[model samples]
Target chain A: MSTVAVMNGNYAAATAARLARPEVIAAYPITPQTPVVEYLTLFAAEGSLSSRMTEVESEHSAMSILSGASLAGARCYTATSSQGLALMYEPYFRASTLRLPIVMNIVNREMISPQSVWGGPQDSLTLRDAGWIQIYVEDNQEILDQTIQAFRIAEDPRVLLPINVCYDGFYLSHMTERVEVPEQAEIDAFLPPYEAKHQILDPRKPMAIDPLTSGYLVMEYRKKHMDSMAAALGVVEETDKAYAALTGRSWGGALDLYRMEDAEYAVVTLGSVTGACREMVDEKRAAGVRIGLVKVRCLRPFPKAAVAAALARVKGFGVIDRNVSFGWNTGIVYQEVRSALYESGRTLPSVPFVGGLGGEDITLGLVSKAFDEIVAAVDAGRTPQSAVWLWAPRKGVKA
Target chain B: MSALDLLAEREDMISPGISACVGCNVELTLRTVMKVLGPNSILAIPPGCMGGVGVVGWNKQSGAKVPVFFPLLDNTASMLAGIRLALDAKGRDAHVVAFAGDGATVDAGFQALSGVAERGDRIIYICYDNEGYMNTGYQRSSSTSKGSWTSTTPVSKEGQGGKRQHGKDFPMIMAMHDVPYVATASPAYIPDLVRKVEEAMKVKEGLAYIHVYNPCLTGWGIRAEESISVARLAVKTRFFPLYEARNRKFKITVPVPNPLPLEDYTSRIKKFSHLGPERIAELKDLAEERYRFLEAVSAGGGGRA
Candidate 1:
């Protein structure tokens, strides 16, 4: 008996975490992510959630508790956004390298300096090089589904790397949507109890954890850890296949192709922006336009091969990045996709359009402007030399 | 049971082939601690010398008899709290202990330490206060005594010898958290330290903070054999008074009625060799201030600073 309730993104995420029955949950409050923590504390207080809720002082301790708990061989869950994630970088860096399969929800928000608490992917995007697997979702239902799947993917023997289930903050985290919450038993069947095969804190064993290493042995650890990321590419497919077999809803591997079969031009998007682009693609398809959308779900172990294969035949493509790469003068995802395509030796004229920054809306008009740029690049037989900024004053620093 | 016999009954938890220098006081403290706690406890060691970062480096053997978790540098308190809470959730009463250095406890890790104490999380949080960032070459820490030398606080030509502020009264600060157990111990007095450990183990509820004065031979520029003597003189001079805060009321566990002069303790360690008479008098004044504060707490006046 699955409960289908209209729930906000935070509730959907909290609901999934609750059903997973994490042994330990720790988190600190930041805007857009605070509701998830609040809901978890209430669940723990009301006895609806059976887990040790560690109300830590800061996000650093929040991730630290999860790290220690996971080392204790307990399934742990936590969430944070923007500065909270920034504060927890210490433990966050260790969680993946130590191969602790802890699942954390990242309600994407803008980083500070300008001091904005709105939705943007800049937070998680900044940590793209960090060892954790990054999964961006398009909607609340997908948020609920992918969170449960994140545990399976992170804990799989092939890839015992931690994963951040990132979704747009206000757009998805605050927006309400009808989510089909699965039954506890069904989720239990999908995701088995977390058994730490990698490392465990057992007094009986009396082994050393994180001992100091010289350069030679340190290379082996680094290589082995990196090898796990490549293996994640395969584990992600199989895990999603297993989930698809259960729920009859499958996100097309890492790069979800939308009306791309024979399209002459394409636009790539991630997080919540993918949903709006999907609507645009459907409209374009109905009007006999050759435009399509490519939803990028996995940012790390970046579905390079899949992305290459999807866009190999297209005349041109554009990447809509909600985050800036700073010095590169383009979006972070656009830079990644361009690198992936370049590595694959596929030369398609590309448009790197950065919009929806700092929770600024990436409306249909802005997306249309992006699509036009991609088509213009293809028709002119040239790629844009720099990124096109949308929905902003014309007077900011270039890039 | 005799405390000596109780200590002798247990095996040496520190592997004999460990990397700690001879007469390392931290090694003595760890061995004595493991002897009392037995093999049932779990230790959450952070990136500190005691956890094998610098002085007593851990390798495959790790010199541990029980499970040891090395949390990040500033996360020992949260890690211990997490491990203990996780055990409690599983209906296990296994002891959780945090052995951290001054850098991890008094300064960088203070927030998490205070947070867990407010929650009254059951764990033995021992700050092996060697007084500075000893493992990182004796830089000044919040626990470094006033008028003492450190890499960051060197003697200047202007006649300044060391840190200007008094060494933070960390254990007293912990007592202010109103925790069930807060005590200061020194490795120089084994039986007293063992007694405090036993008492903390008995209470077995809420956070138990033990600020153990661990003399660093390398960092303090003292002879390895002088570690214990230096620690003993520290207590004899009333510089590091051995006391316990029970139910927010303080009591001097080992009182020194006719305390030795501060020079007796300062003379044993090279870290304080540059202190002039003026600095020595200031040091004596700070210890007196601490004594007055301890006396107020002993009279059940809430230990107000």
Candidate 2:
């Protein structure tokens, strides 16, 4: 039996990790992600979490510790946010390349320059190509559910790679929502204890890991890593179906569609902004406008087929990105969506929308405005060359 | 058993032939240390002389009989800590160890090592301090001695400039962390080094760190035949004293009561050839001051039981 409890996103992530029963957990504290580490340590202190927890000095050590633990055939977990993620980049990339099944919750916060720490997916999106399977969640429940499923997907023999379950900071990380905490027995039944087969650092077995390799062997390792990533797409869907069957709740595999069928236009979104977009989709439908919402859940090993197929029947679509793709003049996901469309041999009228940066709210008003632009582009049969900024001028403030 | 008998009887964990430079005492230190650690050990060889010489191996070949791997240069201690935790989780009793160089230890890898000490992670860390980044063409590291001429701290055409600062006292720093074991060993004193390694293995409660002072033959521009002698001079000159601290209780393992003149050690290495009388005297005074401090700590019992 599962217990439904009201908890914030960080607690939800921590609860999911506890249920998974990772053999080792090491994490350092960072804003937004700080509470997750606190909750985990608290669980360990209370004797509920039996994992050997290390209060690591830095995010670098946190990832390094997990990498070592995973290599030693132990299931491991950790959590971090913006700057912490940047600090762990070296070990983070190595974790995936080494193919360690470590699950990390990325409490997504914006990268600093103007120095804001509220909320954004820019942190994880900037590292989309770093080889970790990244899954962005919409709410606290999704945060709990996906983090639990993350272990299963990462430890799958066909897809033995590190994974990141990313959720927007403050928006979901601090926001309270009802979450279904799974029972220990249920989680044990779902995610079997991780058994390392490919590589392990054991004295009894005695084998070299990550030796100085020739260029040819390095290339072979990279090719195998890529193949595993491609294989993970299927594993993600299968795990989602299995979890849904056990829990009666399924976050759509890679891309979750809301009223996508029989709709002429769609607005694509990622992370917490999906909630506001979903409401706008319904609002537009009630006003007799045929529109739907496409929420991108899995960002790495991108669900190109599902995304292209979902947008196939629509006349046009608009992507709302909280993160920018510097040289492209649009958002990161907008470029990704366009690239996927190009690969599918389809060029339709589309609008690129960029807003909600540095944790500024992507309000219902902004999402509705984005949908209007998509509808306008589809009716006019002309795609905009530049991004449509979803900006709202505040009272007594200049644009 | 005597240290010599133990060494002779124990199986060498490191592979016989790889590619360490001729007469590299760091290689000697690693082989001797691993023999003490034996087969029930998981070793982390970070990027340095040992790793570059293929201690962790090239391609599919392994450089050690025990499980060995190359940890990131700055993460050896934390990685070993993880290995320890995992091994404990699986109810396996194995020595989790790291054989790294000074560049990977006192410089980039210090924080992870210090954190492990503070956290009481049951792992053994052995740092082969050959003064500088020898594998990368003798760049200056924090562990490089004062007045030494590294590639990064090069002397001028007039032989006026060298390293401006003194090398960091790293072993003392680990001792201050009050871990279960902290020791400074030397390649010249095989018995002492062997005993320290054995002592480290006996530490089941917390981190056991052994810092070995090895004079680099290739990097320090010393004759290959003079490698062990030069390392001996370092100890005789009181520049790198052999000592150990168990839970803050300090003891000089191989005490040098009548130290040799600093020139005896400095004159042997080309990196310190540029040092004049005043500079050499400064080094002598500094070593004396450090030794006096160690004496005080040893006499005072490090302020705690």
Candidate 3:
């Protein structure tokens, strides 16, 4: 039996990790992601969490500790955000290359320059090529569900890679929502205990790991890693179906479509902004406009085929990215969507939308405005060369 | 049994031969230490002379009989701590150890090492301090002695400049962490070094740290045969004093009552040959001052200084 509880994203993440029963957990505190570590330690203190928890001094040591634990054939977990993610980049990249099945919750926070820390997917999106399978969630419920499924996907022999379950900070991390906490027995039945087969650190069976290797062998390892990532696409779908069978809830694998069928225009989104976009799609449909919503769940191992197929019938589409690509003059996901379309050999008129940076709210008004631009581009038979800014001038504030 | 006899009877954990300097005492220190740690150990060899010499090995082959790997240069201690936790989780008893160099210990890796000590993680950390980054063409590290000429701290053609700062007293720093055990060892004193390793292994709770002072032959420009003797002079002159601290209780392992003159040690090494009378006297006074502080700590019941 599962219990339905009202909690924030951090609590959901912590609850999911507890149910997964990781053998070792090491995490350092950071804004937005701080409460996840606190909750885990509290669980351990109360004797509910059986994992050997270590309070690491830095995110670098946190990831390093998990890497070592995973190398020793133990399931591991951790959480971080923004600057903390940047600090752990060394071990974070190595964790995936070493193919350790460590699950980390990235409570997505904005990277600092002028110093703002409300919410954004820029933290995880900037590291999309770091080899970890990244899954962005829409709400607290998905935060709990996907983090639980993350262990199964990462520990799968066909896809033995570290994974990141990323969700927008403050928007979901601090905001309360209904979450279904799965039974321990149910989660145990779903995610079997991780058993290392490829590499391990054990005195009984001595072997060297990450030795000085020739260029030829290094290339071979990289090819194998790529193959595993491609293989993970299938594993993700399979795990989603299996979880749905057990829990009667399924977050669409890779990409979640809302009223996408028989629709002419699509508003593509990721993370917490998907909720507002879904409402906007419904409102547009009620007003007799044929529009839909596409929420990108899995960013890495990018579901390129599914994305291209989903937009095949639509006259045009617009991607609403909360993070920018800097050089591309558009959001990161906009480029990704365009690249996937390019592979499909379909050149459709599309609009690029960039907004909601640094935890700024991506309100329904902004999402509806983005849909209008997509429709305008499609009807006019011309794609805009530059991104449309979803900006709203506040009272007494300059543009 | 004697340290030599104990070593002769025990199986050597390190592989027969790969590559090290002609007379590298760091290599000897590693071999002797691994023998004491034995097969029931998991070793972390970070980037250093040992790692560059293929201690972690080429391709898939291992450099030691026990499970060994190259940890990142700045994460050896934390990685070992993780290994210890996982091993304990499996109800398995094995010594989780790190054989790191001073560049990986006192410099970049210090924060992670300090974290492990404070957390009371049951792991043995052994740092082979050969003064500087010897494997990287003798670059100056925080562990490099003052007045020593490293590639990065080069002297002028007329023998003018060298390192400006004193080397960090790293073993004493670890002792202050109040970990289960902290000790300084030397390659010249095999018995004392062996006993320290034995003591580190006996520490079942918290961290056990052993810092070994080894004089580099190739990097420091010393004769291959004079490697062990030069290392001996370091201890004899009270420059790198041999001591141990159990839970902050200090004890000089090999007390040098009538210590040799600082020139007796510095005159033998080319790195320090450029030092004039004033510089050599400065080195002598610094060593004496450090020794006096150690003596006070030892006499004052070894609490916190």
lDDT of 2 by residue, A1-399 (tens): 789899999999999999999999999999989999999999999999999898999999999999999999999999999999999999999999999999999999989988988898899999999999999999999999999999999999999999999999999999998998888899999999999999999888999998899999999999999999999999999999999999999999999999989999999999999999988988999999999989999999899999999999999999999988887889999988999999999999999998998889888888888888889888999888877888888899666
Write down the lDDT of every candidate, Cα atoms only.
0.85, 0.92, 0.92
lDDT of 2 by residue, B25-46 (tens): 9888998998888898899999
Clashing pairs in 2: none
Candidate number with greatest DockQ: 2
Worst 10 residues of 1 chain A by lDDT: A390-399
Please give, for residues A1-399, the per-residue lDDT of candidate 1 as tens digits: 677899999999999899889999988999999999999988888988998887778999988888878887788899999999999888898888888888999999999879899999899999988899999999999999999999899888889889999999999999998999888899989888888767777666665577666678778888998999999988888888998888877987687998889899999999998877888887777777799888898998799889888888898899999999888899899888888889888788888888897899999878777777788888898877778877745576664
lDDT of 1: 0.85
Better of 1 and 2 by lDDT: 2
Off-target runs (Cα >4 Å) in candidate 2 are A395-398, B300-305
Task: Compute DockQ for each candidate against the true complex.
Answer: 0.59, 0.84, 0.82
CA RMSD of each candidate after superposition:
2.4, 1.8, 1.8
**lDDT for predicted candidate 2 compared with the true structure:** 0.92
| Residue A276 alpha-carbon offset, candidate 1, angstroms | 1.2
